[model samples]
Target: MKKRWYDYLWIASALYLILGFFNILFAWLGLLCFFLPLIISITTGSKAYCNRYCGRGQLFALLGGRFGLSRQHDIPRWMKSKWFRCGFLLFFLVMFGQMLVNTALVFSGARDLGQAVTLLWTFKLPWHWAYHGGVSPWIAQFAFGFYSVMLTSTVLGLVTMALFKPRSWCVYCPMGTMTQLICRAEYRPERKKTAC
Candidate 1:
C-alpha cells in the first residue's frame, strides 16, 4: 500500500512528546490531538481520525511493527469486550474532568498552581523545570495537567504495544471509543430509517 502524507504524523507525535519534556508549555498543543479526532468524527461521521490520522497510533505501529518491540501476541479477549472499552472510556473521562477542575481551581485562585505531572493519576513527578513563571497560573496548570494525560496515555499505549500486537491500544483507546460513539450517534437515525 502506498503511504499517505498522514503516515508521517508519527514523527510529529514523537516530536510533541520531546517538546513537552523540554518545555511543558508546548503541552498545550496536545489539545489538537484531543480535539481533532472528535471534530473529524463529528463532521465526517467516521473514525477517520483513529483509522488514518492518529499520530500516536502511527507511532505505536512504527515502534511495535517496524522496530519489532511488540510481542505480537493477541490482546486479551476481555480487553476487547465492549464493557471493558466503555468502562475504560468512563475512567479516562473522569480523570480528564479532574484535570479540568484542578485547572479551574488555579484559575479561581482557590488552589496553588501545580508544577508536577501526575502519571496514571498516582505518581506525581516533579516537572517544574519545564515551566517558566511568565504565564498565568491557570494556563500553566492546564499545561501540566494536559501533559500528564498525554504522557500517561502514551505510556499505556507503549506498554500495551509491547505486550500485544502493534496498534492494540487502539482497541480500547478512550478517544477512539469516544469517536466511535460520536460516529454511531451521528448515523443511528440513518440506520433506523433504512431499516424501516
Candidate 2:
C-alpha cells in the first residue's frame, strides 16, 4: 500500500502514545519525549501532530471528511465568545494541575489512580493486556477521568474545526496559547496594506 502523509502522522502519534504510556508506567524518559512534538507543534504553527500525526485526529478527519462533515467554515459567535475562551483556558489549567498532582502522587507512593484507570480502559484487548500492570486502583480511576476529559476536549475541538477552519483548537489550546504569546513577541509579522 502506498504511504500517505497521514500515515506518517499516525505513526508519530502512536509513538507519542506509546512513550506516554511508558512514562506513566516505568520511566520519566517517556514523559520527556512527550514535550518534543508539543514544542514542534507550537513553534512551527503547525499541528504537525494533529494534521499529519495524531491518530485520533487523523481518524476523525477521515471519517468526517468521508461523511461530508469535515469541511471547515466560520465559527459560531457563541462558540467564539470570550467566555468560552476563558472557560477553555481554565479547563486547560485544571488539566495541567491534575497532571502535576498525579505525577507527585505517583512519585511519593501515594497512589496510582491515574495509571490504573488508563490501563483499565485502554488495555482491555489482548494486545493491550501485554502492556498492563503499573498503576493502583485509585490512580486508574483518575487516569480514566483524565482520559475522558481529554477525549471530550478533543472531540469538542474537532466539532469546532468542522464548524470553523481547520485547527480551531489552536485558538484556545493552552500550549498553543502560550506559544502564540511567545511567537508574537519574538517573531515580527509582515506589514499589511493600508486602506488609505
Candidate 3:
C-alpha cells in the first residue's frame, strides 16, 4: 500500500518516548495531542485519531507494512472478538489510572518532580536504576507500567504482523477499543433518530 503523508504521525510516538527521557512536563504536554483527538472522535463517531493520528497505531502500521516486517497473514477470529478487545481496554484503564495517580502526586509537590521526569525504558533495568535515584518509587512504578504497555504493544504488533496482517494489532488495541466506544456512542443517537 502507498504511504500517505499523514502516516508520519507515527513519529509522534517515538517523539513521546524520547520526551519521556527528558522531563515529565514534556510528556504531560504531549497528552494534549491525545485529548484533542478523543474529543473529535466523540463528536464525529470516527476513530480519526487511531486511523489518522495515533502515533502508536501508525508505528504498528509502519513496522508491519512499509518496513516489510510483517508476514502478511490473516488475523485470527479470536483475536478480533469483542471479549478480547474489551479485556484489553479494561486492563489499560486500570494501568492508566495508576499512572495518573502517581503523576498527580508528583505534580502536587508530594514527590521529587525532577526525579519523576525521566525516560520510559530506563530506571527499570538494574544498571539504570540509578537514573531514577531520589524519584518517587510510585512514580517509577507508574512509568514502568506505561513502558510495559508500550513494549507489549510493539512486540505484539510485530508478532501479529509475522503471523497475521500488519494492522491486525489495531483490532485488539485498547486505543481502538476506546475509540470504538466513543464513535459508537455518537452513532447510537442517529440510529435512534432514524428508528423513530
Which candidate number maximizes TM-score?
1
Model 1 — TM-score against the truth? Answer: 0.94
lDDT of each: 0.93, 0.52, 0.65
Better of 2 and 3 by TM-score: 3
Clashes of each: 0, 10, 2
Q: Give a tens-digit lDDT track for model 2, residues 69-133.
A: 65677666765566776676677677657766765677677864342323222333222322355
Worst 10 residues of 1 by lDDT: 187-196
On lDDT, the candidate that comes out on top is 1
What are the TM-scores, per candidate, against the unseen true structure? Answer: 0.94, 0.54, 0.69
What is the descending lDDT order?
A: 1, 3, 2
lDDT of 1 by residue, 1-196 (tens): 9989998999999999999888899999999988999899988899988888889999999999999999999999999999999999999999999999999999999999989999988999999999978899999999999999999999999999999999998999999999998988888553445554
Query: Roughly what TM-score does model 3 have, to 2 decimal places?
Result: 0.69
